[model samples]
Target: MSNQHRMHGVFAVPTTPYNADGTQNLEQLAAGVEHALDTGIGGILCLGATGEALALSRDERESQVRAVVEAAAGRAPVVVGCMAYAPAEMSELIAEAAALGADAAMITPPFYGGLPPEAAIAALRIVMAASELPVMVYNNPHSTGTDLQPSHLVELLDTGSFWSVKETSGAATRVRELRAALGDEVEVFIGADGIALEGFSQGASGWVAASAWLLPEQCQRLWDLSRDGRWGEAIELWKGLGAALGQIEDNPAFISLIKAALSRRGAEQGPVRPPLPSVDTESVDALLSTIDGIEGRALHV
Candidate 1:
């Protein structure tokens, strides 16, 4: 499939595994990619937010991208999440993504301390200008503290450089606004695990989920529910799933909790690079308790 088209279904941002020395575990990364692809996910976006892209040095980011690109070996599109501060940094990161033979590159607005809407639009313009490759914008206003407004995002979409957006900030309405504005001209991905099923229901092309790293089929089932016009089923799942999915981020040790969840599902060996603490056994028990509350409650752990 051409990378130029909308990345569909449940695209997973697999966590970047680290050895004790803080170097990326390429072998494990490759394994993760293969597992995600085999589990019937759509695309693999490495070095994304959930992958702790911001924490990695540029060289480390490049290594993670390279491993994902190489591991996919053309089975599915591999997009490198180009997370950086300045446009110049984005240029280098995106250039590396493209150089590594990535199918596409993703960009998050300036993280930490936020950017004004105009500043974000301008910054993204510069970033897109630097790359010939298609771009996917990442919008997680909760973490970035800056959001891509539906209107301003329309302007950014007008640039045609951005092929999609992974909307993570619980703005499910933006998917409708985006569809109304772009009309299939661009792809809109639901980035909020809490709202992913709703996002898919409301014309969102797909989801780029951190939760999907562990629950690939579960997430995919949600997508299937939305696509199949099973609104009652989808809503029932969404209303309950949101609460549990929301937990992966709220706990003090968020990333570690994510890795632990994946580990429990047999995707073991992922250790979120410290100062992020691993999920304690108590937290694990709590997570399981929450998972049990889901409709099916058939979680692997």
Candidate 2:
């Protein structure tokens, strides 16, 4: 089925905030989402790698999706990360997300097996076939191991199963190649935060931005600048944001850092779930400094 909605702008991949008792903090989570919407974020994506979906229970995933969708309240589109070990598992996630009122599903090849391109394609096709909602194929090579090449994406998009792709190979050139291959047939969202400016320069239609969780207004302004062809202003804004965005994409404890930033800003984002340790004090301080420094810069656009 063709996706009727053409997603664009800053889609925030929010961290799943938890309470100290290890329960899902639905209230705090909803409040954070509400803030993102109020600050002009274009979309909400729950259960992404940034959200520690691999670490959460099925019930927790459901709760988070429900909270975010309800908090969005039709003001913006919401996409649920539905990547799983197999087609049936992914189909279950997609169904649950769709039932919870998500606008679309962001899916990837099963990460565990290191499947080759052909096998990965087959698995994704099976999952997409079972999905009731529009699917945005998520191509995160670092986390997933399987790289969805532009050619692979073209093949999949040709099937009419996917309406968009989150290209996270971390190469801005991939955006150029995908644009060259598919033209306007599908939306291409840059998934890596560090290369956002380059990706936008190369024709990425949107950004699935983790940084937006902390800096929604800044992220949205960058999107507006890029969309309006104000590269000079966008580049300058990106320069101010580069340090924070780099840390978000490059740091080993990025999720912890994100939660810490939110907590510092007075949001009730508790510690990240364990097995994922907390951000170092120094790193948190540095992130805060970078963010503070960026915030001081006037958005010259």
Candidate 3:
């Protein structure tokens, strides 16, 4: 399939693995990409929120993007998340990603000072002008502290600066609102894993999911069922994986949980970076139990 068509599916956002000495484990990052491809994911998103982009230095971020792109090697589209606070920085990142073979760029609004809608537009325009790759506007108000409402999104779409929007507002209704406003002109990717089913049901074109890092098969199944109009089956799958899916919402240290889960599955994803502690044994056990339950159900089915 063409990269544009492949963009609209389960885009796995893998965590950035760090060594015990607090350095980027590029080997593990590559392994994560291979794992995603092996499990039949549609695309890979590196340096995203789940990938802990903000905590890494510029060099580290670029290295991670290069590793993912090389590992993917055209097997799937690689999207690099640009979370810089300035347009110049975002542009530089996007340029580097494009040079390294990233299929697209995912950018959030100018953060830290919580820029208004107009400023966000300016920042996006600057980045859009700087890079040649298609841009996906990431509307993650929870972390960015700047919510790009439907109106702001419509304005951004009007500028023709974005190819799609990753709505992480944790609201299923936002999907309908975006579809109504943008009408099929722009793609809408559901960013919140907790609402993947609901958002897809409401006309979301794809999912930018963090859970796919560990639960790749289940995540793909969820997307397949939803896309095939098997709503009842999809809802049942979502309910069965509720505990595992809720980790992203219940814990602020979700990257840690992602690493822990991967470790349980025998992937050598190392520790999370500093300022984010490792997942506690109790939490790890709970996540393992949840995964075990899901696997058991799959066996029965």
Better of 1 and 3 by TM-score: 3
- Scored by lDDT, model 2 comes in at 0.85
Encode model 1's per-residue lDDT on 55-104: one tens digit a residue: 78877877777888888998888888777778898888777788889988
Residue-level lDDT tens digits of model 2 in 98-168: 88999999988887778898889998888876678888998877777889898887677645557788988
Candidate 3 C-alpha RMSD relative to the actual structure: 2.1
**TM-score of predicted model 1?**
0.88
Query: How accurate locally is residue 130 in candidate 2, as Cα lDDT from 0 to 100?
Result: 65
Better of 2 and 3 by lDDT: 2
Lowest summed lDDT over 10 consecutive residues: which window, candidate 3? 1-10
TM-score of 2: 0.96
Per-residue alpha-carbon lDDT of candidate 3 for residues 226-271, written as tens digits (9 for 90 to 100) = 9999989988999877568886557777888888878877886787
C-alpha TM-scores of all predictions: 0.88, 0.96, 0.94
Q: List clashing residue pairs in candidate 3.
A: none
List per-prediction Cα lDDT, in the order shown. 0.76, 0.85, 0.82
